[model samples]
Target: MMAGLLGNNVITQIGILVHDIDKVSQAYADFFGVPKPEARWTDAADKAQTEYNGEPSEARAKLAFIDMGSLQLELIEPDLHPSTWRNYLDEHGEGPHHIAFFIEGMKEKVTLLETNGFPLQQKGEYTGGRYAYMDTFKELKVLVELLENDK
Candidate 1:
């Protein structure tokens, strides 16, 4: 098997699952001395449903986009439903959920990881990019995501 492609060539967004959107967003804003982030919701996301491990459910999340220097920080609060953010909060409190890496070959990279014994924990795509989660934490304890630059 070919070695998986992993590199820090791109600086992507960092997603944090928060219990309180206002408080968490404020903390970052104050710390960075940046203005408060704008809160937004996605109707497409609200209407979108996903199948997780064979269970079908809606994926609705409130989002706040904050500019941190050159990088953007996305703070997500899942509505009163079980979602990926909710699951992460339940397991690891409110903190960093995933780190997205910008790459050229997303499908090929995902296949490489899957074929090399890394089963997908979750996979989804938004208007901006696509993402996947691999259950290879013992060796690589971070959520890996490949994002296409939408500029």
Candidate 2:
């Protein structure tokens, strides 16, 4: 079911760019009285397919996810190359990077948002899902990520 927000899925996750995901995740876990979330890095092979500013990039970020019931907190540590995470850290320092929402038609949603001035800043795939970060910081004050899974 589509969430009420924007007539689409709800904000299911909050993405943060951090200097050290392991450390930051641990801190968050400790504060919440939970175990540290599992960490995974974007595959080196998959890295080549990632895009930053519409060009191929090798950037990879170590990711950790904590399920807070319906909503999740995502931590990202940009380990290599230049990506949206790296750019956020370099330009704005460690903080909230994006608010993520799961959608049905990933490509179409991305295109729709783009036409409204939120261009795709970066995009990549994981095991069964893909995500695209739209550059909305300038107008919306926060980057928005569109996630989709073939589940």
Candidate 3:
């Protein structure tokens, strides 16, 4: 079997959308005995060339990550900014939001996906590299994210 996104790992993180990030992260850590996840807040994601529903967004989200053996569990609480987080919350009411793959050659991958007809939903640039969320819910029944961190 082929490992997808073969850079650091395949499907490295599963992102969950929630109303309260700290609450859920604490609950998971306390109840499940998992290590507490590192929490951080993202910027407005404007410079990442973010577009929500085909428009620029000033969206921000609180993110937390718990490191599993190979995979990771991410918790995201969308701030009151224009983002897919709000859309997922409004439509699905807090659940598995997206599966992220850590990879290299981000622009190539994004362009490849776009060539295959998976239009980009949102993208943002962080300290290292960049990331993008693809709109695949219609066919795959879930959103997909691509991350390139080792810039």
Cα displacement (Å) at residue 51, model 3: 3.4
lDDT of 3 by residue, 1-151 (tens): 5454334446788999999888899988998797778779886555555667678888888899888888888899988876888888889998998888887788888787878778888887776778889887888788999988874
For model 1, where is the 10-residue window of minimal lDDT?
45-54
Q: Model 1, 21-132: lDDT tens per residue?
A: 8888898889989888877764443434353443665656788988666676889887766666677778888887777667666667777777887666665566766666
Candidate 1 vs 2: which has more TM-score: 2
Candidate 2: count of backbone clashes, pairs at least 3 residues apart or interchain: 0
Which residue pairs show collisions in model 3? none
Clashes of each: 0, 0, 0
Q: Estimate each model's TM-score.
A: 0.78, 0.91, 0.86
Expressed as tens digits, the lDDT of each residue in 56-104 for candidate 2 is 8888888899999999999989975788988888999898999998887
Colliding pairs, model 1: none
* Count of backbone collisions within predicted model 3: 0
Model 2 segments beyond 4 Å from truth? Answer: 1-6, 45-48
Ranking by TM-score: 2, 3, 1
**What's the alpha carbon RMSD for model 2?**
2.1
